[model samples]
Target chain A: MRGYSGDKDAYLKRLRRIEGQIRGLQRMVDDDEYCIDILTQVSAATKALQSLSLGLLDEHLKHCVAEAVAEGGDAADEKVREASEAIARLVRS
Target chain B: MRGYSGDKDAYLKRLRRIEGQIRGLQRMVDDDEYCIDILTQVSAATKALQSLSLGLLDEHLKHCVAEAVAEGGDAADEKVREASEAIARLVRS
Candidate 1:
């Protein structure tokens, strides 16, 4: 229950909408919508996602990393490393 | 005007909501809600994000990568590489 076990409904609700958005984007393509229009949708979708990732990263830092720091030891080091890697991935995206 | 220049309003709208969700999670934390509950929110948030990334990746493959494949050459290679890197990052996340 410590990992990915909470707020399932809320997450699912948001994801369902995002999924619809993606499908709508596909229709735009199938209909041969302007290339720029499609790219714009893609950008918007990606930004929505990037915002989500950033939020998760923020939580990880506040909770997971902070907990590790309190414990003090290898767990602390590992959590920091994991958080750093997550940050790097977000940066690259 | 090619990249991320289309559907700007739609993108902004979606992002705004996702932002609200993140803030909700943060408030959950500040209130000292159960760790698992907070984690559940984190999981939900991360999954939402992963879904978004996957959508963008899908569009990139269908449109950006497809265009490059049609051209065939250094540009093709670059586009494929970029797409691949994006995939690798998503997978890792």
Candidate 2:
């Protein structure tokens, strides 16, 4: 998130929306909604979260990792590794 | 999440904790924490989320999927597919 604060508000807003979606999902279950209906909502919520993750990844690459690379030392190596790991996790997800 | 109300409170609490952790990580980055240190916090926060995913997965399997399978029809097939897709996403992450 380092120098990526420019988009931080957007990220937070998206996350809040996702959170509301999740709460709606829980309420669907509580109300004993139809199975397929609930699943559809789950799919939507999951996609929203994945979108958030991708956005964060982009910010990390452009700001934090970019800074590390500019610094050119142990910091660079750490940031690169972290970014790679994050990408790997998202890809696996 | 269908039929999983028994542990709903616990899930909500954990999700709240994870949300807080994510905010804390963002703060760390904003405060110009060292690269590796921020990464460490990110790792912790990610693990917390993974834990929440696992819990939800368990609930889905035991309640939603289980009920669907017991019903023995289109519902069973749909639930299984949805659950499989969810697991696939989590694994990819």
Report the C-alpha lDDT of model 2 over A1-93, residue by residue, as the tens digit.
Answer: 354467656655665665666567556656756544554555555566566666667777887888779989899897788778866765554
lDDT of 1 by residue, A4-49 (tens): 2354455445545555656676566455564445545655555555
Model 1, span B1-93: residue lDDT tens: 223335445544554555555667656645555444444554555555555556555666677778889989899998777666666555554
Highest-scoring model, lDDT: 2
Pairs of colliding residues, candidate 1: A6-B40, A40-B6
Q: What is model 1's DockQ versus the real complex?
A: 0.06
Cα lDDT tens digits for candidate 2, B31-85: 6554445545545555655666676677778887898799899989888888787
Question: Total clashing residue pairs per candidate?
Answer: 2, 5
Once model 1 is optimally superposed onto the true structure by TM-score, how far is the C-alpha of residue A30 displaced, in angstroms?
A: 0.8
lDDT of each: 0.58, 0.64
Fnat, model by model in order, equals 0.02, 0.04
Candidate 1's displacement at residue B78, Å, is 28
DockQ of each: 0.06, 0.18
